[model samples]
Target: MTKLLNVAGAISLLLGFIVSSNAVAVDEQPQSLSQLQSLGNNNQNISNSSLQQGTFNKTNRSGVLLPGEASAQELLPAAEEGLPPPFGANLFAGGYESERSDGLNDDYVVAPGDKVSVWLWGAVNQSEVLTVDNQSNLFITNVGPINVANVKASQLNQVVTERIKQVYKSSVSIYVNLLTATPVSVYITGSVIRPGQYAGVASDSVLYYLKRAGGIDSERGSYRSVKVLRNNEVIKEIDLYDFVLGGYLPRFNFKDGDVILVERQQATILVTGSVRNPFRFELDKDESIGTDLIKIARPYAKVSHVGVVGDRADGPFSIYVPFAEFAQFQLKDGDRVFFNDDIRAQIFDIQVAGSYLGPSYFAVKKDTRLYDLLAHIEVDPNLADFQSVYIQRKSVAQKQKELIDQSLERLERSVFTAPASSDGEASIRLQEGQMILQFTERARKIVPLGKVVIAENGKIANVLLEQGDIVHIPAKSDLVQVGGEVMMPQALVYNENATVEDYIAWAGGYSERANYEQIMVINPNGMVRLNATGALKPGDQILVLPKVDAKIMQNVKDITQIIYQIAVAANAIK
Candidate 1:
């Protein structure tokens, strides 16, 4: 008997441990059958007595047996008092303790048509199934339809005990069980990787539902404006960008039946133009700056005079700068850099060749003419071929045609003959890169030929010749030579019209050592000599013989006699 009692006690303790473990698992107070039955109130009422009796029978068989002398009825109460609350309540009221110690509010109560399961300790033979009706009440054996909804489980236990005390001799404990819960769900959509509805979502947080729906689509979604809708109304918008990067997730929590919507990303700026590579860059990060864009534009760009045409929200603005300056300047999106070649108009070069005074490259104004180029050269009057003068232009036929057309236009408009206007004449303006070659007709000859004539008083001599005309200079033997302390030495033609003074001038005039008194012209034909007044021509030689100091007086006398005789002859003629 002792061993049997020990075994029975061990079994009881094990059951107790199981019950305690179950009770500890309850997050909230155990709900009563009234709450569960109310969920299915329209259904048939379930009996609790049978369930309780079954529980009582099971406990009785597993424990110590009472004495044969002791009544089973008395033993039952003793047993009930010794057992947990469920057995005592079941013995009197066919129920268990409705009150629970777990922390939970009782404001949300189980209503009609609720299904509930009941468990009673030491009442294995009685019914433990129950449900609430549509009237928000549960019917018990001793206690009638008791209002359980909106009543705390702990409070309901006392109410059940009081009602059962009227029929039972001892106090009874009761337990309530709820088997159904309120339905709840939430919707997550818009820019989310997976947008859908989530059922059984708790009222605690929106993030739980969002996570279950999959996080925001970072590539195409905007974290800055995540909208939360409740009852079809936008209640709040959360910035997920801040939370994700800042490690602050608590700021965005969801409630039951809440809808979370991630918006799509907005439009961003695009950069192109004088850059190594042109592309569209996203403004997703905070590091996008104007200077950063310039770094990308450095290649494939002429840094000098980079032009930026900005298309902005307001109006368009244009900026130009050297490529270097542009790199130093901050750049922005939507700005286009246009690189163009600089066009200039100014002086240009032309080449001159052939028998020109100075054949070389010359710089002329953009609108210079062929005449302007020739004016610089010193043309030899006897050598230049004026009638054959021509300008050799170096250019393609097309260019030459264009030039001809322009020249004709100028001629027809009389622009060349027009007086200079304030703005300057068009014909005077030479086109850039034009070559002007001026030719001379006299330049083709190999020898020089011309006629020299002396004027009265021997003041000057003039040479007249046509373009390309050559004057034959007779060899030294075919000419007259005059020298002797003269101003200039001369070799003159014998038939030329030159006086003694003209010869003197040709010989660079007389020197201080010359004996001017004895000036004589020698003819190769004989020993006869002539005076200075005698006209000399081609093939004649004039010799101004020099005298020594000893013959000075004789020479002076002879000169005096000649002067007197010439004066007498001039007077007789008059």
Candidate 2:
């Protein structure tokens, strides 16, 4: 009895396990469309029943999961009912349906030469067809051409009714059919895949004409640069690329006589001057720097200098840069890049001496001009004559011919020449590590005689100076002498190119009492009267004289009048 009970218990446990698995599988199954709708209806019913019982919870009795069991197909109609029509939809859909029926007639008026069609409702023998041509009046009718062509179907029905009323007076209806329709033609040309004249089509819309002309040529055409020409003039540029690629709808519709044209791309960046391959490169992207120019010149180019030449609407600019340092530069479209092969070597030392720059000394590459060394040591302009400047140069065997040629050119141009034996004359080339000494016989004599006017507010006293050297200025004097009067006058030492107006300005200019219109300049050459606009010379004296006042002139005139009256009275007495 114990063995039998154990086997029975195992069988019952297996059966329970199988039933539980089947229950889970049934719960995981997907419901059909009809079943889903039934389930939704049941839920709604349950909520309603709970509400009637007055024991419904807030969460359980809110609403049904799918109200009214709405399907996916019904959702669009439901949404559209709650919204307004899209733009142009109301006008495009059934907007012109009311103006369709205005002409209708059914009647037959027979003439001897007229053809007419007539039909009775149930009598075929009463039907007749007739025609009228080239007569002032119909043979069997009283209707005329003026009355036939201008008459509407309804008006013709009224005329037939009046005629019938004269003969029997019967009511009748009439109908008319047009044998021809209106003609329309449009022409499509320029930048299209196939261009021709099309007929029986709408002439006012570009999209309608484009569809007739095989649309845009995407493989060989640019949709962005399309231009529409109307009556030989550009009306608009249609960006079809934006419409096709960006999903943008066009705003303005087309009109009659429009011509569409597509523009070609423009080439940019003219690379010329010493480049291996010089051509106009087209800019495919946003490029505004000189890097691409360097890349174009990298092959078969030394690139010693890269010159950027640009011309805007305002003006033009030219900038030269070393090729090694041109990486920091930027370029614009239409800019020209000139690649040169001639490279400049760096200078080690430059010389300084005499009227020259200095003794030959090693210097940097780009710092070997004449003005650079002149600023270093204080050189008196009055004592150091710069006009007769010269330079001494040394060259190895390899550079002998070139240096000689350069030297001869410099001498011919007077860049380097011999000195003149005078107070304001000297010459010599400067070498490196050499000192320059400038001296003048007059400077030595005037050093003991005190300061002479080298410049205004600056004095020069030549102490121990030698030949081929420079001198320093110590102090300046303020005294300027004015000999003749014009206005407030003073004295000034004469400069090399001093003029009469400069002296007048130094003496506080012309005063109000002075006659500036007539100024007299006195020099060793003699007195010369001149206007205020006249040029002045060194060692010249200016005379600023005051005009006679009006009061003094009036007093003199009164005295003369009194004397004349006395003389006249005495003569009358005699």
Candidate 3:
């Protein structure tokens, strides 16, 4: 009785406050079909006078809408941020405009305006689609009115069949089915994207109306306590998490003027990374345990550790805990949790390409050396060029790419930022900058092979092998190649007695743009020698670099350095 009095006093106080604020409280009617459609057209427009009354006037405890009271849309991050949309936000993506009323559930209660198809044969032949009247009675042609207002659809067949049997006396065969359910206009209020009246069939699930109302306000709306109010009392309470975590939504029939009040969000925790459902989850209480969060997060198999960060009594705090001990960890309101795959692997796989007869891939320990694996690699002695073996590492490629990008950036900055003393110099610089820009774009597309020189001076270095390394053993080749700024770039028969100049001469000499001083002789194992003039061996490549002439000596130097960087990184000239 004391608690009831306290509630009564609170209600009286709320009414007095509403009157004093000059806010007239009236029964808002459900919108028409056109108005409902217009409401969904723009979610921003739906929060007009009705929404202000529902969200601010009535639900506002302090009689004023605080800045902290934000709608669902306001809570979401900007689309430009590339963040994931809030959980259950996609539920209102539309398609709730029309729902089949014929698919009725067994527990659906009979209501006014609901159509029932009754067919009779045998003694009496009558087929009629009867509508339920206001008094919840379906009037038959000859039989008296049958009360089916509150009767379940499942029991309607039994009730109507028994009544017809009484009238026809075992001669009439009756078949009754709930043809169409009554359409209802439900008032959706509280923390939702659009707080307005939405029209849907009585048989339609609660999600239909919620979807039509633009789903729950992800930021402010409480998915844990969605109430369906009839008259002034709550008839059903829906927990959307039950539907999200476990595919379960409570069954309920909505009536006209029914209010679905989504209470403001309670305590929440933001979960991200290495979890199946990485979204902000609302808690039933201010404080919960890791076990409660585990049920919602559903971390992936690779996730072994959890990092939690939030405020504490002392100050802001953070802790990294193993997945096993997370169950016992205490979680607070507004905490941020991140699951991580922190455990290092004991063994990693590496691929071996070219000339080896054994398995293409091998899973080896972290301390496995290149020489240890090389000893086990079965190769044809006549075909395999073991002396030209090298390792291609992904990490090396990434580092080489970074260095090339940094050099290109520096080259671009130098070309564009060079001080021009006169208009003629500026014009020349502008034209040169454009040409350099084109060259830089072409250079940027080159992917470095990341060749690690394991063999030098005919000796293989037994270095530790890294993850994702490709150990390549070249095939025996008796061909010498000549390319880059040469008149005719082609592969020719290997001449062991020929020098670097002889290979360039055999390829029809250098072009007009070729830099005579910048000739490079590349070995089969990716070792580059500048202006090498000794006797060239088989599988050797002679590349003639292009000349770079700039008015500024620094520009010429930078371009030459970039050329060398590209030649070493990609083994090609730009």
Candidate 4:
């Protein structure tokens, strides 16, 4: 009852404050679709109003809103420095593709069962929807029979126009449109989940059939390449990577008797860089592999050294091979061979500092991204400022320095360009020049690298990196935040001697329902700790977990055991 009364009081106080301040405007529906989306749009109207009121505080009058209850602008906007999306939402939102195919190499051939409309205006003034016969012949009034078999779809109008012109002396306009594609029964064989004939349209996407057949036979299938054959001749090859990365399907419409064969991804290796023909090839056990690779990937004559990165059971290992022995050198599965003709090209280096243990500097290859480097660096979750990992590039710093220089030069010009003045005015101009020079010097001292803001979803942000980029990973700060079931969740100033108990006291301690023993602390690196020694740091967040009264929770005993363990360890550390 006491806890309920306290919460009620806080609510009443917040309401009274808002009513007194008149910070809120008239309630109306959001003006646009963008307002409905949680895309971090600025909510500055209320904040600006608060500032105008001379002084406004949130502690004694904390006005918050539940979702669907009110807008963040009207209530609690995402605190400016917003939190991450609930999880996996932003990461996988992009690269999501539909199973429908919308591309084709051919302009759509008029096949049997295809519905086409041919309109003969002017001389004849007639329109008819004609289904192409099995023999690819279209019967027309007055024009008789016209053979359209194996004819390009784009040429259908020209072909029909000529035929229609024959029936009339006056020039007549003809329009031909393919309404729908003919359905095809394609045979999917070899290394497929369910190899058999699948019924689909000629324009149907390959994924549709694969999905219907329960996907590929994982153990025996090839993920890199699949062949689409028309009359035993390879018409087109489909690479799954295209669909995965770009959501684009191959432009090959299946015919009635088309065959899709999935070859096994065996003895696969990649040859890239200076090689003329860089591709992934599957080899047969009896075939001479090295000779085939040499014939396919024609390396330049000047390429003396080739870097062969081999993947083995122990770990990944690479070695340099001579150009002479490149053909004869034995290759294995999962081997990546890179050929570089220029032996002494300039190298690119980047520094990834803070929250990392290894050498801060790394000599990376071209087109490396922020996430690519982040994958290699290991930061303690409890200490990392994940939302704001930033990149500082040398080029940006140079641009900023140039701008400062230009501004200082402009100020110097202003003094010279000024109308002729008295000696006292001249003395004031000299002082102003000195001030501009000092300001310029200060601006130059400001580092540009750390200023590039990195959002929580950097990958989705599509932040690119250039040469001499410095990726900054921050450690936990000095002000610790107390949240969860605290009477007043807030950030407290940290002292070297302060513990979690001291920080909780600063937050008005835990609420009546808070589980004191089951306290959860998220360290500076975003790591969760149970029964942590509450040696609070600037960025550490202490959460007083809520008690679950569910008797059906099977892990209740285990959780209690873990909580007790944490309590003991934390006290011992203290």
User: Over 4 Å off in model 3, which ranges?
Assistant: 1-85, 98-107, 152-155, 550-554
Best by lDDT: 3
Q: Which lDDT tens digits does candidate 1 get at residues 319-422?
A: 54444454465445434444322222234454543334443555544454333444443334444322222222222223423433343344334422335454
Given candidate 4, what's the lDDT at residue 436? 40
- Residue lDDT tens for model 2, 1-574: 3432332332222111100000001112322212222323222111111112122111211112245533222222322333222111122233232333211222222222334343332211233343444441212233223234433333544544444335333343333222221223556675556778654311133454555566544333444456767778877766553453356744343333445564443224555556655544434333556665555444244446555565666886555665655566666655655565444333233333332222223232233333333333333344433322222222211133333234333433342243446543332122100111111111111111011112211111111111112222221223334533334556687675656667778777865445455455533222233454444544445665433233322222322232222111111100
Worst 10 residues of 4 by lDDT: 15-24
**lDDT for each residue of candidate 3 in 10-35, tens digit (9 for 90 to 100):** 22221110000000111223121122
Mark the regions of model 2 whose C-alpha exceeds 4 Å error after superposition.
1-263, 285-287, 297-301, 344-574
TM for every model, in the order presented, reads 0.22, 0.17, 0.80, 0.36
Alpha carbon lDDT of residue 465, candidate 1?
17
Top TM-score hit: 3
Model 4 residue 223 CA deviation in Å: 2.6
In the range 1-574, model 4's lDDT, one tens digit per residue, is: 3443343332222111000000011112212211222333242211111112112121221223334532212221222234222111122233323444432325666677777788877756878888888888888877777778876677877786787677775857778876767778989987777889988777666666666555666546775567888999999887675564467776556788888887776666566656565555444432344566676567765465555666677886655554555567677876666665534323356777666555677655445544445555555667655444556566655554454445545545654466536986666545544544443344334333323444332221335556566776766476777766678877777787988888888899877656777776754322356778735556666766655333322233433342232222121111
Candidate 4 C-alpha RMSD relative to the actual structure: 28.8
What TM value does model 4 have? Answer: 0.36
Report the C-alpha displacement of residue 385, candidate 4, in angstroms: 28
Candidate lDDT scores, in order, read: 0.40, 0.37, 0.72, 0.55
Query: Considering TM-score, which of the candidate structures 1 and 2 is the better prediction for this target?
Result: 1
